[model samples]
Target chain A: MQSDLKRIVSKLHSGMRIAVPVDYAGVSMALTRPMIEAGLRDLDLVCVPTGGLQVDMLVGAGCVRSVETSAVSLGEAGGAPRFNAAVKEGSIKVIDATCPAVHAGLIAAQKGSPFLPLRGLIGTDVLANRPDWKVIDNPLSDQKDPVVLIPAIHPDVAIFHAPMADRHGNVWIGRRRELAPMAYAARETYVTVDRIVEGNLLADEMTGAGVLPALYVSAVAEAPKGAWPYGLWGEYPADVDELKRYAAAARTQEGFDAYMSETAQQGEPA
Target chain B: MSNVLPREILITTIARLLEGVRHVAVGASSPMPAAGAMLRRALDENERTVRLSILGSVEHNFFTNGSCELFDSAGQGRIDAFFLGGGQIDGQANVNLVGVGDYPQVKVRWPGSFGSAYLYFVVPKVILFREEHTPRVMVEKVDFVSAPGVSDPEVYRPGGPVALLTGKGLFSFDKTRPGFTLESTHEGESLASIREATGFAFEHADSVPETPAPDAATLELLRTRVLDELEETYPAFAADWRRDLAALSVPA
Candidate 1:
């Protein structure tokens, strides 16, 4: 399991576009830590719709060159300090997007389509800023009706944490179906799971519905509490106090470095 | 009645606005709106229950397909109402969730636009809720239009801003006029005071009435049931609200 993680982490190179799941759907700190430890640089992060602590930490650590996301916030804890600061400092390129646009782009990639047409974004600065996105009249409508066409987003790797995986490498994502699209659109998908089950997940009718086949999964590693601080659905609740502490500490570069060093020394459990 | 907290008033006001909506969706970090939606559900006297989908809540949210399901549902006109708050909201109702100053090179950065860019165009009732009512937040024109309030006649937009609710007052948006009309001032606010604080010009009657306070029954429901439901998603907000209620009830 450790070897698999090391192999997957070794494959990650600088200037790669990596797709990651949103905060609540299991953000893999296990996978993220290794990438940071490897000192990977100039990575383009695609936050599948939105981001939170994971995106913030990567930006603060200087691992990310650009971020294509709908929003990056700490939710109840407050604004993402590092992401906000980086944006203000112009340290990272922000490919600002709406939630649907991000999803639509990924869907286009999954279907091998060039682009997908989406409603709204007309006459807004979001549309005005993106030269990549084009406005075209609806072919079906007789009258003038316009829609925004979002280009396909293909990522080099898609990574996330999940509750469990079968021995065959099939991941059970349950209702967090967004991970499927991420895996489908990316060239490779790596997962860190809490537990590895003995049975074939796809064979069981109940679990089969939620399973992502091994075909999309390149490798799987057993990393308990991989989403520490951020909670996995039904596994545990988010450690709000710890998140708040991080939020306060990451407000400044010095404080962020201190927090990182302290956590590194502690060697947070997988 | 005098012991009512500011947030309670806002929640009640939101509940009133949410009336008749079959399904309402509340986004992340919006405790007041989430509480308001819950209140609307609790206040439902009809046989049909109001379906509330508060994003980020494990209990309330029904979407099995993840965040994209929300946009998909809204696109199909399944979501009746949604809440959108911005860093800067202009008189024209253009919301800037992006940032202040300039595009890409903004002076003050804000969380990027979430679903507002699309949801505002699809959801029939897009309530503009900003807790602070000041010139900095309520501007003449937003630095960036994360989502537009009104679109061109040729635009296939079935939804837009219906009302603007702030700490000071409640204003209704008229798509035809593409402007705001001050509806009612909250407890301590008057038309003159609202005008002084607001950055842009808005249409208001000579004598605008004060917004009605929640009755005893509504207050009881909010303090107990609404707060109870809110605790699941917003624990801190719920705790703080309870603390505020406790302090307010003490003899002066």
Candidate 2:
């Protein structure tokens, strides 16, 4: 299991763009821990639509060089302290985006298209700041109509956590279908699962609908409670108290370091 | 009538604004809006079915396809109403959820724009809700435009702001005029007070009406059915609201 995790991390290089799913869907804290421990640097992070704790921790740990995201928050806990501070200090680049734009970009990549046309953002700072995004007249409309075009966001690696995976490496993501596009748009996809079931997940028609085929999964590791602190859909609820502590401690760099060190000590072996 | 809390009034007002809507979608971290949508659902249960989709709720959310489906649904004109809050909102209804100061290096950073940019243009009745009514929040112009209130004539925008509700009052937006008009003030607020609190210019009637308080039955429904449903998604907020109501009812 440890070897598999190491092998997955080996493929990751500094300055690589990696994509992760949003918070409500299972986020891979297990995978994130190893990358932070390895002192990975200068990576471009893409939040499929939005992000929360995982993005903040990576920014705090100095592993991210740029964050292309719609939003990064702690939900009920409040604003993401480290991420906000980093952006204020100009330590990292922020490609500010709206939720649909992020999804549109990934969808474009999944379809091998150059860009996808989206409505809204006609006269906004989000569009003004993004030089890569283009506003063009709708060719199909005879009347003057304009739309924004979002370029494809092809990440080098896509990572997330799930309830379970079978021996054939088919991962069951349930209704978290956003992961499918992330997996399809990336060159490689890594997943950490709570457990590996005995039977082939794709063989059963009932479970087959929710399964991501092994063709897109580059590697899978068995790590129980892989999405700790953050909740898995039906597994557990988020640790709000712990998130609050992180939110408070992460307000200062010294406090953040202390929190990180303490967290590192308490981390269980993979 | 005297026992009504300010939040209950806001919830009732929300329900009023949401009347006749087929489907209303509330986003993350908005307990008030969720409560409002639930009240609307409860009110329309016998007469008509008003579908409510509160994001981040397992039971209330109807989307099985994940987060992207919300934006997709709104774009297709399936969602009739939505709620948006901002760190800074101007008279023009421009919202700034990104932060204050310049781009990249901001003095104060709030969360980045979530689904606002797309939903504002797609959701027909986008209600601007902000509990904090002050000069700092009600700015003349936002530091950044996370979502513009109105777009160019050539832009493919099917929706825009219909109203702005705050702790102090409710203001209706006229897209043709591209500005806000003070509709009604809350119990303690007046036209002069609202003008003093607001940073931007807005039209107001000579004698503005006070926002109507929730009636006895409406209050009863809010205290019971609405809070019960809201507790599933916002346990702490529900508990706090109940506690506050309990404290209010005590002899003082």
Interface RMSD score of each model: 0.8, 0.8
Model 1 misplaced stretches (Cα beyond 4 Å): none
**Model 2 lDDT tens row, A1-270:** 767777778878889999998887999988887888778999999997888899999999999999999999999889999999999999999999999999999999999999999999978899999999999989999998888999999999999999999998999999888889999999999999989999999989989999999999999998788788888998888788888999999999889889988888886523
Candidate 2: which pairs clash? none
Worst 10 residues of 1 chain A by lDDT: A261-270
Leading candidate by TM-score: 2
Per-residue alpha-carbon lDDT of candidate 1 for residues B97-180, written as tens digits (9 for 90 to 100):
989987797888888999889999999999999989999999999999999989899998989999999999999999888899
After best superposition, candidate 2 residue A257: deviation in angstroms?
1.1
Q: Estimated TM-score per prediction?
A: 0.97, 0.98
lDDT of model 1, residue A139: 91
Candidate 1 DockQ, CA atoms: 0.87
lDDT of each: 0.91, 0.91
